[model samples]
Target chain A: MAIREPIRTGGRSARVQQSIHRAVCELLATQPRESLTVPLIASHAGVTPSTIYRRWGDLPTLLADVSLERLRPDTAPADTGSLHGDLLAWAEQYVDELGSEPGRAMVRDFINSGAACQCSNLLRGQLQHITERALQRGEQAPAADLLVDQLAAPMVYRVVFSEQLPSTAQLKVWVARALAR
Target chain B: MAIREPIRTGGRSARVQQSIHRAVCELLATQPRESLTVPLIASHAGVTPSTIYRRWGDLPTLLADVSLERLRPDTAPADTGSLHGDLLAWAEQYVDELGSEPGRAMVRDFINSGAACQCSNLLRGQLQHITERALQRGEQAPAADLLVDQLAAPMVYRVVFSEQLPSTAQLKVWVARALAR
Candidate 1:
């Protein structure tokens, strides 16, 4: 008699999820987007195509899932001593991540998947964190929604619609505008 | 003898283009999005599918073209005797047009077709028209780009991502904020 891997256990499920997600990222890095398929991703991940289908439903949804994972901020917004400094630092990093070629692609995928609210929610939570930290330090900080309206909204608009990212100077101007508000 | 229609002449070509566009709008209103095809559109418009292919290249591009056509303002932004009143009226109408169900779909189609800048340029021209009218009256006006950054960006962002449109009251607040700047 052989010991069997328990079915649908957290440890095994987590590992498989990780492997699938990692396979998607690696293939996206190496392969053309148009060439990617469920079978190809499954083969790369050492799983069956049914696994991807049963879990993700389709290619766009899976791409959206992977993009959302990549977009999740790994650390808290830095405490830069003042609300202005904190907002500037956070905005710079936000642009650097979301304005890159791959980042833009992720945004498009997220939008196409019809789960754009999730992506916006991620940004909202991060901005809220920055504002709450500022309040704790006795600094006046703009509301997260206002920051989203003034700073992140414009940045995202440019990223989605324009060929160029907002310049550092432009980002600074937006930061100042939000702060002034 | 049957009169030979001028081949590829502006008059004939413009008529064909108009018919094709009209057919698309009709089909979109009545038929489900997924069921639409070039052959169907060509049949409805009484044109060959090759004509659509040769001109618009693909379905998404054709949809984007139609969406842009619909987005063009038919008249100038209303001048309400004050810049504040002008912007408020314009913003309310802007939200009403771009925040409706079909309007949101057009926005997504434009973004997906990657011709979003054309859409933005149309809006920028309208905002510039408002600002110019205000200046002609010797009233203080916010820069058009500033309005785009503060007002239009947030509106488009919400339209693209959120389930609910921004309320009329929110539009008033945004107008006040833009004018204050």
Candidate 2:
């Protein structure tokens, strides 16, 4: 007998969720987020509105779920052996993903929601993982919260205010400085 | 007999500008920014729409001008005896002003433009002034741009993302951390 994942409701549930996620992405690509509605998304996904409501409860929750689906990495970056390398790798991935239009929109939605959004928490978790690995290497690392403030805040600032993503070298300098002290 | 300021295009010009500026603030207090228009502001100010057009050219420009009018301090913070005092004072003032509703709206307008809005440049100039003052006191300060990244970026991140303005104590902690070698 095949072992089933604990969270899996079954194949049909998974398929419906996947279809809804795809429809949201397609609509987001062409339409302004403000114009997106449950009814519209349900029609495009070929599922009933009730299905969406039952699954996600509301639009913001659904969008947050979709954002996580698109953004969560398949697996955390392999341990790079040094804090600096791990941080640079993480920052580079962030710049690549959040620099895109869809990524940009997802972040804006998350930020505008005021209280910490699911995406911010997701990124925080990723930062925690990297910092834990750095500690495992016998390196004294800055606290994860401090790293997030220094690395993530500035980067997200550029994306939101200036619409310019920091270059890889810029990220490296910031990471190197933080790691050094 | 007396030397006069060249840019002070006196009397009627100043009066008209003041009226229009006052009207903008009054409307901004009661209405959503998106609903504001040149004609509405003109009528409220007792000026013609053509006059507003001739003066500021567009809504963004007018809003930016009004923001500066309200926000620009009469003088840069007088040189406090220490860099710590200077930075804390500056950050405190920043939190008080930008953390308010009007200031928040102005910043939102700047970010929504997705370009180098004047309000952003104005804030950068203010940051530059504070850093320059710190350097003048023979203190080793972080580069202004780096300071911008570390200091200004986090403050803005709190405002935009978390919607919680950093408390005065929080700003002081960040300033001290950045200023420390």
Candidate 3:
């Protein structure tokens, strides 16, 4: 399925969305996730609950919208001149970003929103880009799905389900395993 | 940390617990997850909301408790005469059980519950048991952690995040990959 896009992109509709998103972020910083409600967020954002309900449908969907916005990659993957170096650099950065407490919270929101595949696809696209670059350079590189299986899946599982995040050393092992013939 | 046990495991407390759990399962079968609230569950179970809150802490925790109860394996992994056959059979069954719609909902609850590590450890224990059995039979088996990293993680990531479930063919590939020298 195609990724869900914002219903409105400009003018007053965009401004309302921005304010609502900002309210959620601010509330999350101070309050526990369970305490958050559409009525509370609407009040904080100076809008009515009906407005939020009409636009976002529910709290999970709204949280998903906010999380996807935050998770969007702002820049391309780094160019390290080799597939091994590039994958290592990318995997290291990925772990550091997603392994953080707030990042894990975003993952929880994405998963609970029932739109987790959208986030997965975003991550997969970046891995595919990296592999394509390696293929262009005639350097050996693993398929993107293989990277998802060997590298991303384990890292995500650790971050979301395990008590400890995957260490940098573990990230190295995963990158090596993915690149291994 | 040890798994959380029931505050009271016998008599009236046990009866109340059973009633509450049954109510949750029944409600879940009929109502959307988002529509479920402690008060609603209490009304259905013929108890007070405070009783649930005092016992389970919150909705997510209660959901997690219900999910964990449903997820506990009733029997040991099948004995297939060889490590390869055993792993293959186990992975196939794992995908089938967890890939279903209801199973996926349970996974979302576990992830949102802040107690996901408990579930992961349970799965790890089962994998270790399988590996130990292989070792006893003098068959070479991959380490349990390796199986988790390669087989469990990929299957889980797909089940919880992606739209498509991993097929039996894919389970075989994961088993082969995990067992590869």
Candidate 4:
């Protein structure tokens, strides 16, 4: 009487899997940080824990995929034609993003398990690249990473520990101060 | 009669308890992070499991105090007559101390239990005071906390996450960059 949406027929199953995967990530984004366990993740995707466990094997593996899914590796480099301008733009973007609910939740999740997630490592790599780019442009400073760390650390601490987001004005002031160096 | 050190009391019972507490902390510092437990802590501390349980109530409380005892917050904030200089000096001293074996051990301990510590409220209060001081100096900006976060976060992160003591050059550069604004 009616044609049915194909169920579990190779390509069909892959498509369905893709759809469910996206939903799982979407749910993670929308939910509170504390509720991101396997049970919840499966429920959010309209699947069973067996399905999830079979697909990802463990929480860390699942988390690694979800967190890095939309994270393109192109953080603003230290070169908006000027080192200061570029760093400021990076700072502004970093601060604004971190101020949001999702960003705050992401930070808390990373900090909670004694930083068992690979997210910190990923973020640290991005920061390292930003510094390296400056070096490539012939800027020399021994404490560049320290300077960057100083500028970036507070937002994370506030997000993960204190549950507050950085204000835009504060972000600007911080960038202005760091660039002034 | 023997004169016992203040750390361990005269009576045999007191002596046993002192050895046990010290042993627990030492094990946490030296052993793999995964090996921490009531039994492990008690065994290392040279006391019975009952004594360890009775005193600490749980792994978290005992771990918390022992971890706190390991940090040396430089009491005398160096006054190089200016905020920038003082901060740099402080960063240098802190990083140097953090580079030591004991410092590393303490940091590892904290990183492992950071979630269980619940010190966010305390951190917020301290941030408030720092903000007030900045305002008093006629240098208040919207992102003052962010500025502070950037500066402090890197040091904490590097120690807890990377297992590397940030170089002095890094600290100096960071302070210089931060105060430039």
Model 3 scores a TM of: 0.90
Writing each residue's lDDT as its tens digit, candidate 1 over B143-176 gives 8989998888898888776545788788887888
Q: Please identify which of the two predictions, 1 or 3, would achieve the higher TM-score against the true structure.
A: 3
By TM-score, how accurate is candidate 2?
A: 0.74
Q: lDDT of candidate 3 vs native?
A: 0.86
Leading candidate by lDDT: 3
**Order of candidate numbers by DockQ, starting with the best:** 3, 1, 2, 4
| Model 3 lDDT tens row, B159-180 | 8877678988888888888888
Best-matching candidate per DockQ: 3
| TM-score, model 1, chain B versus true chain B | 0.89
Residue B90, candidate 4: C-alpha displacement in angstroms: 3.6
Q: Candidate 4, B7: how far from true, in Å?
A: 19
The segments of candidate 1 whose C-alpha lies over 4 angstroms from its true place after superposition are A1-15, A47-50, B1-12
Superposed Cα deviation of residue A3, candidate 1 (Å): 35
Report the lDDT tens digits of candidate 3 across residue range A1-181.
Answer: 2236776778898999999999999999998887999999999999999998887788888988888988888988999998888888888888888877778877877876777988999999999999999999998787899999999999988888886778778888888888778
Q: Can you list each candidate's DockQ?
A: 0.55, 0.30, 0.78, 0.22
Q: How large is the interface RMSD of each prediction?
A: 1.4, 2.7, 1.0, 4.5
lDDT of 4 by residue, B1-181 (tens): 1112234458887677567658766675577645688887777766778876665566655565464544423354554545555566666766676666655555444433443234444333444444455566766333444434655677766765455677777777656555553
Which 10-residue window of candidate 2 chain A scores lowest in summed lDDT? A1-10
Q: Is the docking of candidate 1 incorrect, acceptable, medium or high quality?
A: medium
